[model samples]
Target chain A: MESLLSPVILFFALGALAAFARSDLAVPEPLSKALSLYLMCAIGLKGGVLVADNGFTTELFLAAAGGLALSCLIPFGAFVALRRIGKLDATNAAAVAAHYGSVSVVTFIAGNQILSDAGMAPAGYMIAVLALMETPAIIVGLFLARRNAALTFQPRQDLLRETLLNGSVVLLTGSFAIGLVVGKAGFVPIAPVFETGFTGLLCLFMLDMGLLAARRLLHARRLTLHLVLLAIVFPVINGTIGCALGAVLRLDTGTTTALGILAASASYIAVPAAMRLALPKADAGLYLAMSLAITFPFNITLGIPLYSMLAKLMV
Target chain B: MVISVPHRKIEILVDAPLLRRLRQLASEAGVSGYTLQPTLGGDGDQGRWLDDQVTGGAGSKVVFTTIIDAAGAADLLSVLEPLLDEYGLMVTSSAVEVISARS
Candidate 1:
């Protein structure tokens, strides 16, 4: 309840409301992109400092492996559901599946804040897992879609290269590694910039996101009744799997919750870019509407809280 | 140096995903060369998009423009019509008389 009411979320709500009312309020494109960079750097740095203090542990290795497994496997399940229940064809099914498999960075950030405020912070090394989870699902998705097609899937190399050196991945891992190397001593001087200002920056980013998301929902196209239901249902199922794994791995409740939120969260950013490369024939309106319009808001508003509750149950 | 030649100015504002194919298609269609520019913002039937907005996919926009002889334009346009039809790209080609190749 508190997480839902936090200024961060409320501001997001306000943005969505403004958009719903068709107000002219909007975040300029360049500023929004810069906000994204700001959030990633701050989160990565904080995670790095924590890792520096705690040092590497075996648990981090298991979590990374667990996240990778989820990223790669969830798509297969999503693809099946989209095909059977949603009645989507090969290209659209795989495109939407790829999104369900990949994690959302902002949703994870929101989850991290929710957990930290609740006093059981997740481990720092989870930052690395977040970056690791970005790519494999895309590769899996492309392979699944092209498996029986007459087309050769000639753009795999381009997709692979784009995914590998994607701007988000590069910035995220680079900042994480830098934080790891610099440790606390380096972060201390920069704390005022990255740490103190974090929430304000996040609120603004979420505001922009809310405006975009609600507008996308208003313009939602090509989504059917079954597809909408599948979008909601898939996250709950996938999040549960992740929550169970996190608990079995002996992660604390907060970390488990964070993991669950991640598992449930679908990519709106990275996956869309990758899909555009890998599946040109796929309809952007369908996949983007499903992921951004339906799944993203669901996760931010209800999914995080639900995943947290599930994590608590597991613990 | 200057020369007058009849040509087709091909302009393609396509999703980033199609960039590689666009280039390849242009080459196969025998264009002299093309200038590819990364687009930061655009609007279309799908919706408004910006490079900075983190919708995160290969959905970033790109603009590819090339000038080719009138002879090759027909073949390129033939291929592009179906390609654009399928991919939902915004494309246009217009006949132009080249003022100068080099100056």
Candidate 2:
């Protein structure tokens, strides 16, 4: 309940309310983009600072490997569910599967924020995990789509560029690297912007995200009831699996919860562009409706706390 | 008096991610130049989408405009036809008078 009532979450609710009420509230596109960049940078730097303090640990490698494996493998399960249960055709199913397999940056940020407030702040290496988990599912999804006889596969340089070097991946990884190089002492000057102002900026960003999600949901014609249910269900199942994986690996509770959050979250930004380029025949509306509208709202509002509770149970 | 030359103005409303492909097709069709403009939001066969979407390139679209000779327009349309159905691209070409020097 406390998690649900947090200012960031409340602002998100407010944005959704405004959208549902047909209010004209909007975030400027450039400002929204800027906010996203700021958040990524802040996350990366903080993660780097923590790593600087902790040095190299075996846990980081274990988490990274687990995250990579989950990313590579989860799409297969999602592909099947989307195909058999949701009755999505091959291309759309594959596209949607890729989104499920990838991580949502904002969701991870929100989950991290909630956990930190609860005094379970996850390890910094989870940021690295977040960056690593962005692209592999896209590859799996393309493979799944290609297996269908009707879909034609073409190798394009731009698709490769978009998938691997998308803006979020680049900024997140680059900032992480910058933080590593700078370390804690070097981070002092910029701490005010990235640390002190993070939650407030996140609140503003959440407002925009709420508006985007609800507005997209309102306009979703391709989304079916089955698809919506799957959107919610995917996170719970995958997140639980993630929590189990973390516990089996004997990670701390916060890191375990963070892993669960990553597994459960769906990509809205990076994978969508890749899908547009690679799976052009796929229904963007359907996939976006599922990921941005359904899964995202579910995670921020309810899924985050649920995963945290599940993490406690496992770890 | 300035003389206006007849040309076909090709305008394509396409998803932002497809802008690169559109530009490549335009170049392939021998168009010398084109302009891209962002759209606010609109409802169409696929439903409504807003430009400010945080999902980045998926829901956002751009208007790609180019003025070219009739043959060039025909070539562009021919190249784009294959992708039109798959991408749901909205393409239109109209006869227009352009100031020859500016064009």
Candidate 3:
């Protein structure tokens, strides 16, 4: 119960209410982008710092590898389920599948925040896990789309360029590399800008996210009940599986919970843009609404705690 | 001053892939190039904006083409019309003056 009233949840709830009330409140784009970078760097540097403290082990490597493999595998499974259960066509299924397969950076950030607030610490290498999970789903989604018998349109080179080098992936991985090179020494200079300001900026970003969600919900009538149900159901199921994976891999409680969060969160930004390019025929409203509207809020408000509790039991 | 001809400018809101296809068709229609700008926000039949909060959904796009001659415009329109019919696209064309023509 206390978990529900945590400062993180309160921020999300406040943002949601403000948005629902139709306030013109907003977070500027560049600032939001900068906040995103800060979170990535903060998380990455923290991970490196942890590694510096704990030292390397094979278990860390195994966990990171597991994250990559699951990311690659989930999209195939998601594609099949989306096709069979949701009755989505090939392109739409692939587009939706891409989302499930990719990790959400914001969700990961929130998960870390929640864990930190709870005074729990996860493995540092999990930052690498978050970065690793970004690309494989994209490959799987593209593969599924290209297999259509009537597929007439091919994505342009520029679209392909954008997908692989999208801002989130670039910043996350780039920051991770920077963290490794500089380690504790480099973290100091940027600490005030990236680390100290992270929470306030996150609150601002969540505000924008909340407003966007409310706007999307206004157009929610366009999506069918099946998509809605899938959005709610799949994340829980995926998170459970990820928890079990964390257990088998013997990850710590915090790391396990973080893994569960990673598995549960869906991509709203990078995946959606790629889908718009690779599967233009798929309705953006449907996919975007499902990911942003249903899944994002669920993870932020309730999913994190639920996953954390489950991780405690497993770990 | 260069005399501008009576021509239709077709603006279509399309995803990146279709935008690429349109540019290819424009080149085939003898248009040397067209301007493609990233869109900030708009609404349509599928719905208005996105659900991540209106802001995350802010960057949906539209492509603009300036076709001076009728044949070139027709060729581009012919290829684009059928695609738009099946997909989430807004197509509207208006007659406008070029005012200045470099070509």
List interface RMSDs for the candidates, in order: 3.2, 1.9, 4.3
Error in Å for residue A162 of model 1 = 1.3
Error of 1 at B19 (Å): 2.9
- Clash count for candidate 1 is 7
Q: Between which residue pairs do clashes occur in model 3?
A: A211-B53, A211-B54, A212-B51, A212-B52, A212-B53, A212-B54, A213-B51, A213-B52, A213-B53, A216-B51
Candidate 1 chain A weakest lDDT stretch, 10 residues: A148-157
Candidate with the larger lDDT of 2 and 3: 2
Q: Which candidate should be chosen as best, given lDDT against the real structure?
A: 2
Could you tally the backbone clashes for each prediction? Answer: 7, 0, 10
In candidate 2, which residue ranges exceed 4 Å CA deviation? A153-155, B100-103
Root-mean-square deviation of Cα positions for candidate 2 versus the true structure, in angstroms: 1.6
DockQ, in order, for the candidates? Answer: 0.47, 0.61, 0.31
**lDDT of candidate 2 over B1-103, digit per residue (tens):** 5679899999999888778777887788888898988899898777887777577778789999999889989999998887887777888999999874543
In order, the Cα lDDT scores of the candidates are: 0.83, 0.91, 0.75
Q: Give lDDT tens digits, candidate 1, residues A212-261.
A: 78887776656789999998998899889889999999988888887788
- Can you tell me which runs of candidate 3 are displaced by over 4 Å? A48-56, A146-149, B1-4, B16-40, B50-59, B65-67, B71-89, B100-103
